[model samples]
Target: MTAAVPTVSDAEAAVILARCDELARHSSLTDGIERTYLSAEHAAVNYRVAGWMTAAGLTTWQDAAGNQCARLSGSTRGLPALMLGSHLDTVRAAGRYDGILGVLVAIAVAGRIAASGRPLPFALEIAAFGDEEGTRFGTTLLGSRAVAGTWLESWWDLRDAGGVSLREAFLAFGLDPAKVGDAARAPQELLGYLEAHIEQGPVLEEEGRALGVVTGIAGARRFLLTVTGSAGHSGTPWPRRRDALAGAAEGITTIERIARAEGLTATVGHLRVFPDAVNVIPGKVEFSLDLRAPDDADRDRGWTLIESALTDICGTRGLDLASTQVHEAAAVACSPRLRAAIATGIRSTEPTTAPADAARPDEGGSDSGPEAPADDAPRELPSIAGHDAMAIAAITDVGMLFVRCAGGISHHPDESVTAADVALAVDALEAAVRALAADYPAL
Candidate 1:
């Protein structure tokens, strides 16, 4: 059996929380946190966090993509690393813990591991990804994607709100655009990737648990939908009017209905109508559709049905229907190897709250969990929100731990987590890393 994982002290927990507040100060928004890619805010946080990593006993450096990274050599001369981390960027007006908590927790965990002086078979590394939220450039996971060797050449042309192209921003940030590829890591360089993030949902809190296991991430697709019709007088006869807005309203409602019935997550978040004159009937409408599902086949099927419904809605309204696909990502499941290790970590720590009875094999976790967890097993669920792990999945096996966030709130200033939970999470994360290290004995 694996040795019992150590629990973190409250003082350690307090330090992690304090660093989050300090990180918030680097934001551009005085009222709320808003750190973007390649901004001064980004550089500030990288420099600050790199200092913390060094104090934690790791060799620190910034990658070509501007991500903050640190490493501790293994007992052997060379070996692929057991990686840990999460992104540091936040959405505009974001809550404090969304991505911030994960990085801080990783640092604290690294500190504990380094202080122990335990020998490991694999090196340990931490990655504080720079641009997971994508608030500035309108593209998510830019930092992790670049590191995964999936960076698209066309992204250089992508511009921020200030009209600064990504290539130009790279120069301003003092990163060589041509050398960005140097950040990419081959599969052999990393044994696996692990991330700890706020639940960003109420599942664990609602269940009175401080942490949970993430089974997989939802697959997502986004589209720009347009409906076109002829302009007409406001008094036009009902049968003669090809009202694009009316059709769009129906389409939005239909999307919600289908999403509900098909078990998908769909939203018509943005909508615009042309010909805004009070007297003239609107002739064109444009809307954004964000569709997601537990898996690729489910998402694709729901999209097909929604598309067919929109076609029929427009056909009946005498309007034309068109759609442009903008973004797509396949569902990614946690690696069984890493999942078991995380489960071990969680099991080794006592639950913050009592569970009704000893948790059986089926009480929590994915159906494929290797074994039953402890008496108060961590709740298991899927993540609907995207993460840097999704991008990293392209290069190596991935796993994630979700700490409870108050009220399931994220992307707002009200996001919150408890010190007790943070301490538990820190312990769980460190234990997981230790478990992975034990798997490969020192050379």
Candidate 2:
């Protein structure tokens, strides 16, 4: 016989949705950075979230560095706790569901557990991380890294576009930079973590799936390229003068071609021309390139090609070239045990369908062979973008479940998801949390 479908009340789902809307309405984008970590807005939304946590029976508190926490004590108090949460902030012009879903769902899960009056095997702690987007400071995973004891003090000296240091930003938000170390927690105390999020990609929608089981976080390398050449009159013949803009254009095309040839992804998202005048040939051009891949070897190979192409293009164009690494993050793998739990939970919710396939498999091994039976359930895919869970996964076991977003659009006013998708994800999450907390042996 099929197992019963895990259900979440409409009221609970509505509450979670409402919280998402309310948080989005606030202008929490950090000043100057303006993409994430708005001080005033973070304060406003976090306060409301803290109040909600208390009402839901959690003992809520804010850490020295401003991470908000809500604790629900389990019968096994001395045991390591289960963490369920996501960041409260957003990228500049971010959508409501990106990070907010994880936080609100944790609240909903904790609330449901309390109302059910069932004793849990381990403690549950819901977290609303301070700033995962790094929209203000150009550094992502600010909160989770601190908790993981991997945060660097030099990060405090890094400045945003506005010239304000992270230390100063923390002070502006009433957090002490000197006390950042206080945020660290013993690794043993964190049993496991789970984050619910929007897929932020087209994989799920293209496959007609409701949810995705994430396997690993993609590695990213970002750089700023500056191409310098002599400026000249726009009226001058193209062959007579060295033009930086022309060289930059060639570099951009080369990057695209190399990334495609290597089967990696690269983007020239931002560009600027010196003087930016219509009449000038342009003395200098600056652009930003972001490259990403699933593993280090692939990423390194792609970057090697990128540099070679840039060097050759600059030499042929007689333009000076300079590049600097702006950001780099190594890929992180999810725990096998937690991944199995998520798959089991999803399959349990819709037993008629086969379990979603793992996005990544062991080396030299296939998760499913060519003749493997097809499942009625949709397949899960890996995420190219970064999220708070990536940071948490560095120090503790963490897993992620992604609900389908409409049209795969996110980080904009037009981003959205359906209520039905939300309901399904929440149901799966509730089951997963219960099963993980129940001490079921690893699959």
Candidate 3:
């Protein structure tokens, strides 16, 4: 049997919040956070995280892929590790706690376990992945991909907004580009991975819960769609004009309609129209399509429906349609054993003040306060956003814990999490570690 999980004191919660604030100060933006991979800010954050890792009683190192990693031994020397951590990178103008909280929570878990002085069957490892957002190079999960042994040779040529290649950035950051392959780990070397992250959506908050267990990460497919027609004077008669912009407008509306009807999330975030002048008819229109679903087959079906609709619309408008898929990432399902462990952890950390269930209309519901449900059934939801765990899933089983974020907002400066929630998350994470040790004593 495993030992009792440690209680997360107020002091520990304060330290985690303080560390998050400190990391926020190292961002490229003065007004907001923007720490990209391999940038100067990236190096600074890694150095500080390494110091924290050592303080937590773990040996530290910066892996070849630029991830700051630390590990604590278990019952024996050189045992396969159970990895716990999240990405340390952020999007442009990002919030302070999205990925940072997960890494700090992992460190706290390790520290608490180390303080107990109880040996385990597998090693406890923390990996602060360097690049999960891919904001700098337009390719996500670079750090996790390397560790998963799925690094692609084409990534070296990818360029940043400043025209710097990934290879060049690695050299400038003092990482040997040629040694990047060394970051890869065989599946046999790891037991599994666990990440605790903010929900980045309104589900938990809406449900009046502080925590939830992730069911899976959504699979995503991105496409570049273009509509072509002949440009003409604005004065041209409508019957003679083949307006691509009009068709694009119709296409966008149809995309939203199809997504809503199909129960998927589809976004057309970027759009460009040629001859952008107000007095000229647009000859061409281009837009980006990002579609995500909880399952691969579902997502593919939605895409097919979307494509068919767009094609028909464009044809009706006498416009030519073209599309190319730029990126695709498969969905990742969490490990069932780890999922149960997390659920158990949530129950262990349940606050006495939890209010009534929000699902029941008779229950008085308020978005501002936590609602304790009548049952111990922790809500399980799939992550609509991408994460490092999705990449690491290529190598080992993975699980995630979702903490409620204020307003379900992320990737923005306003992103926020309550101190009470953080405290609860730490408690849950510590319990999860203990539960894992008990269930998988043989590693």
lDDT on C-alpha atoms for all candidate structures: 0.86, 0.77, 0.89
The regions of model 2 sitting more than 4 angstroms off are: 1-8, 28-35, 351-378, 440-443
Model 2 per-residue lDDT tens digits across residues 40-77: 78888889999999988999988866788888888766
Candidate closest to the true structure, highest TM-score: 3
Position 390, candidate 2: lDDT? 79
lDDT of 1 by residue, 234-282 (tens): 9999989999999999999999999999999998878888887788888
What tens digits encode model 3's per-residue C-alpha lDDT throughout 1-443? 67534345546867888899899999898888999999999999999999999999999999999999999999999889999989999999898898999999999889988888897778999999999998999888999999998999999999998899999999999999899999998999898899999999999988778899999999999999999999999999989999999999999999999999999999998999998999999999999999999999999999999999999999999999999998899999998988988898898877532332322111243312454654758889999999899999988899999988878899988787766677778888888888889978554
> How do the candidates rank by TM-score, highest first?
3, 1, 2
For model 1, the local distance difference test gives 0.86
Per-residue error for 443 in candidate 3, Å, reads 4.6
| Model 1 clashes, total count | 0
TM for candidate 1 is 0.91
Identify the runs in model 3 with alpha carbons over 4 angstroms from their true place.
Answer: 1-8, 352-375
- Order the candidate numbers by lDDT, best to worst: 3, 1, 2
